[model samples]
Target chain A: MATTTVRLPRVLEPAVGAVREVTVSGATVQEALADLCAQHPTLTVRLFDEAGELRRHVLCIHNAQATRLTQPEPLADGDELAILPAVSGGSGDGRFEHRR
Target chain B: MTTLAVGTDKGAWLLHSDDQRSWAVDGPLFPGWGVTAFGRAADGTYLAATGSGWFGPGVHRSPDLHAWDQVAAGPAFGDSGPRLEQIWTFTTSLDGRVFCGVAEAGVFVSDDHGVTWEPLRAFNGHPTRAAWQPGAGGMCAHRVLLDGDRMWVAASAIGVFRSDDAGATFVPRNDGVEGAVPDGEPGIGYCVHAVVADPANADVIWRQDHKGVYRTDDGGDSWERIERGLPAGFGFPIARDDASGALFVVPLAADENRVPVDGRFAAWRSLDGGDSWSVAGKGWPDEPTYTSVLRGAIATDGDGGVYLGSTGGELWATADAGDTWQRLPGRYPRIATVALV
Candidate 1:
């Protein structure tokens, strides 16, 4: 049984907002994510899909580089994981502050 | 269950489900980018536009609605004239063509499924530079609707511009639309947000401007204020049912941009073509809910069903076009944008 740790960005830490870590064992990263998501149902919406497939826009980074090739795969022993959000916009708002 | 997408200033998410009682969600989306916009096409392809303040600009594309590919990454748009900088607003045409409305560079469009892009030559060269003043956030084309031969574009202070032949050209048309400051300053509107074009009617349009709700019957040629039953006509988003032209908007507090009195954070729908409205904030929080629904999000399904996710991390839905509202259980993901795609 291999175990891994996951870190979320500060902006995203509040999404789950509560108990941030769970221990899961899987041979591949997919199995590991499945285990993590299964342990924390509240983190479900922030993790997987209704069909059990990984949501495309969301990224799960194993170690430092992006996990583009190894999604839904098993995780190795002590591999660190990080979840990332998708930013969408163009240049314009930098000059003027958001006036609320 | 509706396959949902919620993008917040914090990040973006992809939600999926078939069992109405239960839904599956995934990702804070872009951790570094800070997602604000989500666009899903007909074939289930999803595009998330992120705004990485001081970091960089990027977009994520997911072919299967889950498990995305970092397909495009760069400075969102141009820095100054003819240059792209950090993107704040990303929109998609009905045909799934991607368009990014930048701050200084005017606008850019991607005909290659968001993988590549180009500039909007016309609006960028509108010849109305001096007259087209910048808004608080410099400016962006807040909302965009593509017509057969022209594109209807709305911004903060540049008023409105129309482009013919796929953003190849632009013309300004600002008549009947009015504005005022958030502090009731004399004549300060033009900070418009969401722009909706009736998929069925080319000329009819709806927008949630800075000060009021507006409708244009002659495309962007002219606009009329519609404020019959709204608590406050101004909001960040105005949603239209792609199938019915049913207009939906969240009312903000009149004096301040908070929840309107009576806990009516529910969405209002105008079936009589934007003339009158009714309350739909039943299950929505009643007080102190300052969830500023950002423009370009807050959408409805084909069933006249509306769904809104807020920066407040609350996901609320109405199965029957504001007849009633319900608060669904989900992450308080600071919904910067919402789509029932």
Candidate 2:
């Protein structure tokens, strides 16, 4: 069994938990996320949308290589995954703006 | 039985008060999720429409408002259709059919009281899909009103639509409303921010749109400008006092800046329907305040209480029909909607 470390950004830590890192076993990136979701069920909703797709604002990087929840790459033992929110300059122009 | 459900970007809260003065706040249900809208069923079941930056939209049903069970069946699209982005409104008809309006502009119904949802294909696959483009908030069907066999649905940037045979077929009803459309744009579809049907007269409907305030007396067959007494033309959250036929609206400055006019917070109210309006700002902050109220952030309890939630995370309540207001206790995430029960 391969053990991987998953780290959530500080902004999202409050939504899931204060703990930044969690370890899960998997041979591939998808397997690691499935195991991570099983260990922390609440994180599933925080990390993915209802369609089980990664939220639009969420970006995940695996072992320093950016990976999408829609298309995950394989993982290796001791690999690290980091999750962060997409950056944007919000506006109050009252013109319709995309939020999500 | 005076209860308020405040749906926020972070979670959902239930505020209860017996005399409309002291309130007891409960929960951050589905913590860290955005609760876009919620409603109470006839059998006292509370259904919350929630989504998040990491997760998409889903419905959570609560029997006692204390414990919630996420429903297995939620809004979904077929393999090739646009996905359901967010659940913008949850409503129950007199006949007990629960209806949910979602982004990508579609309606869904649950005859089993939120247990399962099926798309109202007539509205979803309407022939006007090509011309109905999304507004700033995306193509969302946010408001649903039912009167007998007649129903009204509001889709942003697409104007108002009416269905006489109960969601089977629909036709556009934007005869006199205005949109932010560019010059020479064909069709009359406009951005409708919020809409409320008259409790006493189903045919009388008031709307707060992207450009102005309007009223339709002929059940949306046509509409007329009703901003004669409003301070500004752009704002969200239009609610009505059911018992007295009084209407309320929060007016922001303009399309360029979506804050209250002059940086002051106030709610404009009309006693005799929409003939005229008066500003109500008593008990609000005197200092400069810059915040906008979203489409569903305002609600009336029908007795006398008027409640509004601001994007600034403040909850304001008026006990005597907007004559005076009081800021509620806590600081919450941006509020999406407030429901009074």
Candidate 3:
């Protein structure tokens, strides 16, 4: 398995000891997330939905490019996967604006 | 010292008071997350239900309210088609079973403290499931009341449902109530904001509905309007003081406005089982204050304390059964739920 680094958003730090990133081993994007969740189990619900699918608002970036969680793109030793909130539009007024 | 756990759209705060007048504020714990509800498990573990627009929902457990750790397996709807949006309320049975009412309108139970959860299929998959519609708050099973083997769940724009056989089956309990959506199924469109059962008699319950404030003596089989002192019956929360058998509700202008009547914020209290109501005691602001309290934002400490949090992020407390009111300091995000710990 290739060793990779998984970066989490600040809002999710509490679930993983307040760390910004973690090192995991996996062969693909999904496998790497599985490894990350295995290490920090609480992150599972935050990143994925009950159907085991990546949540609609969560985005996975691989090597500075947006990618799907189920993409089987092979991971290299230095590969980096970043979890970030998907930028979306909502109510223009801040009152009901969607969370970033 | 009496501590109040305030859950808001941003996080959670703990307000401590030694004499019910002066207070100390503790947090915005779980910063940036929407803390929806708070509950103490039968084992006394503090559970906070948190939701994120981007990351979905989660539950955190704490030995005390100070430090919390997220549960690995929280309440979820796995492969059930409907998305598990947010956990609205958590209710624990006398026998240690924990039940969670979640948005997307469903119920889940956990027998092992708050560690794991399983959905009650009978209630979740009712025959009226497809007809269930959401109010402006979105369809959510926001309230759950348990009376031994009988239980009630109130969902928005879907009225109330009762399970007489310990949640094995459920029946719609919206007779004599006006339907929010007129053209929908016969007994399915009544919008129920909140429900509080009489402490001494579970069969006697009070409800703050989209139509008006109502009370029922024969469980939920029938209801009668009970809005004497309330200016307008459009509001979100209805809380009952167990010790005094008093009921409380904050009436709003209308469903369209959703603010306090005439911009004056005051909670109406009923001492004689909701037969009539009056402005609950003094200390309300002299100026016009326009704010709304969500269904779960009002809570009573089994003794005589009643606390209310508003959508504007203000906190108010009444220490002597509404005889006197005080606005607690600190302005955070929109307050969602308040609980006395």
Off by over 4 Å in 1: A1-100, B41-44, B72-96, B179-189, B242-245, B254-259, B286-288
Give the Cα lDDT of each candidate. Answer: 0.62, 0.79, 0.85
User: DockQ: which candidate is best?
Assistant: 3
Candidate 3 has a TM-score of: 0.95
Which pairs of residues clash in candidate 2, taking residues 3 or more apart in a chain or in different chains? Answer: A48-B55, A49-B55, A49-B56, A50-B56, A96-B136
Please report the TM-score between candidate 2 and the true structure: 0.84
Mind giving the per-residue lDDT tens digits that candidate 2 earns over B216-261?
Answer: 9999988899888778988878998776677899899987788998
Q: For model 2 chain B, where is the 10-residue window of minimal lDDT? A: B179-188
With candidate 1 superimposed using the best TM-score fit, by how many Å does residue A12's alpha carbon deviate from the native? 14
Error of 2 at B59 (Å): 1.4
Question: Once model 2 is optimally superposed onto the true structure by TM-score, how far is the C-alpha of residue B227 displaced, in angstroms?
Answer: 1.5
Residues A1-100, model 3: lDDT tens digits = 8998888888785576678888999888888899999989998888887788877777899999988666588888888889987774111112112210
DockQ of 1: 0.04
Lowest summed lDDT over 10 consecutive residues: which window, candidate 3 chain B? Answer: B74-83
The DockQ-based CAPRI class assigned to model 3 is acceptable
- Candidate with more favorable, higher lDDT: 2 or 3: 3
Interface RMSD of each: 13.6, 6.2, 5.2
Q: What TM-score did chain B of candidate 1 earn?
A: 0.86
